[model samples]
Target: MRIKYAIPIVFFVALVIIEKENNIISRVSDKLALKQTPQAPIHTSRSGNALPKRNVSVTSLGKPSSAFTLMKRHLEKYSEHQQAAAAVTNGRKDILLLATTRTGSSFVGEFFNQQGDNMFYLYEPLWHVEKMLTLETGGTNATATAKAYCDVLRQLFLCDFSLLERFIEPLPVDHITASLFRRESSSSLCREVVCSPFVKGVYERYRCRNMRCGPLNLTMASESCLLKEHRAIKVVRVRQLETLRPLAEDPRLDVKFIQLVRDPRAVLSSRMVAFPGKYKTWSNWFMNSDVLIDDNEVKKLKSNCDNIRMSVELGLRQPVWLHDRYMLVRYEDVARLPMKKASEIYKFTGIPFTPQVNDWILKSTQASKETRGIYSTQKNSAEQVEKWRFSLPFKAVQLVQKVCGSTLKLFGYKFVTSEEMLRDKSISLIEDFL
Candidate 1:
């Protein structure tokens, strides 16, 4: 009996040693294979320009490798498989309503936001990144800030809120936070399933009065996102369209981009009213009748115009990836013919023109008077289009025309040669074509 027990014990010890040796060998082989693998070649556009590479660093957030990091890596590796699977499932459509501030983005965003129950719409999800990680706020440079914005957007698109939670003020506890920017703008977040124990129909009023709905449960938000057939995010923070090429190329997403542009002069005019604090200098210049062509504000305006023109030019080039996936819609066109333009936009996005959306368009575009709030979407859109001509000084208009000449021409906005031409509603400023 003793001899039998001794033989079994020795066999067990020997087996353990063998297993340990095999584990070590396997790890070594993996390392060798990894070392031998060549780096992926640089991706290039159809025009043979090298694409910008994202420097993905898990340590950038000062946390250990988390679910978001792992998911990003997994997606990168298995994107082809995921794309095939998505195709089989009839794929979730992702639309980016890309625009600049004070350019009627909020009103246009409602086109997707009010698209009934099947759509998950996020308004300015990048607001947190822009708010938190700016040079003045977080001591980070433009490149870092841009990376953070891109990372946050990518995670949001994947319905993974882990990365975004990091940027929220007063960090989330148990993935629950009330700090989500523009939470009320997202109807899905206000749904019964996500924010429970609330008055069903009076979410806005209830939320405003009592704050009874409590903080948003990001876990629930993610679950809600997964159930939606499509997702749309309206963003004003992303400056360069090329910066988003990777997102458009993402295999798990059927991404479509609608570049919503407005007349830069109108944009400047609107910005002056909407962000009076920031544009105080411009207001002072206008008030004092002192317009400097080479001022900092004027240079910034030129930079903005140049950026928009460049982005528009890139879309027009129609690289293989963006071919048929990109569109340019002027705010003026959409404003002039809401229903017709909405129909065209909906058709372009492959979403149905539901009765709910039609009703919303009819009601929203026919406001007897503009709402008090600067951000309010309700407006007499056709009348609102040329309202800038009255508010913006002729001198300011000429200055904008000078700085944004290329952009204005590219978007088919006619330069107002005089105050009369600018104010005359009958003299159409929008050309039929470029």
Candidate 2:
């Protein structure tokens, strides 16, 4: 009986040992399976929200997650903010008074030109570029001409006159030229400091005439530009705003654009009077009552209208590059309320409205009699805004409306269906545009 009991105990001990060994093997198998299986990647959701925490390590060479990309973009935007702040802190502000011809750019440009000694203004610096290109190649290569215009403008804004000298008529001799386009319009250019060794004290119109002042020394102009706190340029030759992207994006400069627009009908009327020689064909068409939409001159007008409309629309869309950097002002609005509009413009340009600007606006807009010079800025602006109605024939008005219908609508210019409506000054053609 004792031997049998001992045998059963031995069997029981064997069974217990075998069971323990099997349990250990199952645990080892489970660990091996866990090691071989691939784990899901640790990442944020597509919306950039973080995922629940897990015990996982990401490799250095792994793909960037959505959160990483978002953080990178944020860093880049912050860098842009820092750069813009640095620009503002440097006391350098560049203003581009952009407009088309016959859009009251000259008159409006005076807002900056008369801003005392702190402002350096350039009037139509692109004129030289356009004139030279037209003479050299009849401006057939539109791309080349556009590039040349932008290059010259970029240099001018940076106070470098070397590029501009190449285009000046009788090419600037030793950086001196008598024919800086519209030199009289820039107070900075006319000052005793820039004219040099000629006029004394403040610039007197008669005393500092090109004959008396001799040729403009571009070196002196550049020096004056560096001394000024701000630089402003008024240009009408820039047909497309997108062409200036390089200048606008330059990190070395802080640029702003104020685009001035006018009614297409008024612009056409003013162009006819200001450029009678060029518009003689249009005048003949008017006299003969034979205006055709397909005529080259009419086509040119349509192109101009389209260009202006496209630029204005682009600006209004507030592209990332143009954010807080573009403004649009109508000529009629500026004309009817010169002081208020000038204040608004000055505010937009980040400049102080001075007594000089105020006095000039008062004198310019309140003229007793209309100044008849083709390029004159002095006028009774209130009267001049609608003088086109008298000068432009009803037929011409109808033609402009048909060709520039979209532009007119976009710019808040009302169309006249009858000659009586064209002649009625009491009826306001300008609708309020926010």
Candidate 3:
């Protein structure tokens, strides 16, 4: 019985030793096989740009697996993918400066233009597109029209100005905006304002070096141009808020709206002085001079007033404003307190208030004795805030007051009668008009 037990024990011990040796040989053989195997080069995209190869742990089929290791590897890859997607998505921002002409939009546009490399600004890109779209749809098919506009706008946001080529072909450079089709045109005021390497390269690529229009550097994609963090446009041609509603609601686009307004009286004064009708005809008066506006001009004025009212009402209807995604800025207020208002604007838009912007504000707003042009680009505060108060005649003031009285009151501008105006120290009568 002892001999039989001893034989079984020896057999068991020998079997265990064989099993251990087999395991050790298997691991050594597996490692040698891995060492002898050649690694293939990672496949890369045709563009020649590729992400680095991930470090993957190698294992033999016979090796025991751990659920924890597998899960950790999977979680690491998932986190990397997520981070890449977020990096691509988080790089873009869209801002629309919604305002009418002669409402100090140019001045306000400068605020965005000064943001250095982070900003890509287009001044009035939609001015001609709005006209073309209006003619094509002709008040019918509102959905199609808005969609068409949005489509073009999307391209613009992506820095694909080539889409505007067809629209710009028939019209002369004077009638149609050249900047929409050709990047180096006067409308790319930022080329002058922001002369960074990126801006310079983009301008060289997108700009129609020749006056002729076609694909501008097809090799340079829209995505490349849109690599900047902020893309903004100051548009005056869009007639209704409805035209922009789709963009505001698009989940893919991170969009914000800024409504820039001026005192109606100021707007009227600026328009009249800039372009006045000599014969006192309605067309001439409405287009040319702000002095002695007749009944016909009043009708046009009322139309402008109605548009403003409708726009404001529409803005109020949108819940985005309540969520801090929308802002209303007055030209007077911005001119009066630039830094304070600029800080507010910067805070709202999530842009840093850079020293360059601060210096611009300080230098631009300094009162100068230099006689600047009526529509000079140089920032002049005294002229900007209340020029109409001094230059407009008593009769012209009264007419503007009557036409835009309700709008004035709504905007908190105190109405001053001709008598009340004459009493103020700043009032200078236009004797020729009187």
- TM-score for each candidate, following the candidate numbering: 0.79, 0.77, 0.63
> For residues 1-434, could you state the per-residue lDDT of candidate 3 as single tens digits?
99989999999999997786555445433432343234312323336564243232233223565898778867866775665466447856677888887887877777777777677777776655555544543432333334445655755664554444334434322112323432543333323322222333222334433243332321122333455777887877555665676566444456677888777777777776667653255334444655444666678787787677577667756665235557777777787788888888878787787887788777777746574555544567745776666655566567767887776665666667655664475653221110
**What's the CA error at residue 145 for candidate 2, in Å?**
1.7
Q: Which ranking of candidates, highest lDDT first?
A: 2, 1, 3
| Cα displacement (Å) at residue 263, model 1 | 0.5
Query: Model 2, residue 297: what's the lDDT?
Result: 82
- Which candidate gets the maximum lDDT versus the true structure? 2
- Candidate 1's residue-wise lDDT over 72-165, tens digit each? 7777669666654765387578889989998888998998888988999898988876665552233434444555666667767766666666
Candidate 1 lands at a TM-score of 0.79
Query: Per-residue lDDT for 99-152 in model 2, tens only?
Result: 999999999999998999999999999887777656655343445456666766
Q: What Cα-based lDDT does every candidate model obtain?
A: 0.75, 0.77, 0.58
Q: Against the hidden true structure, what lDDT does model 2 obtain?
A: 0.77
> RMSD in angstroms, all models?
17.3, 24.8, 24.4
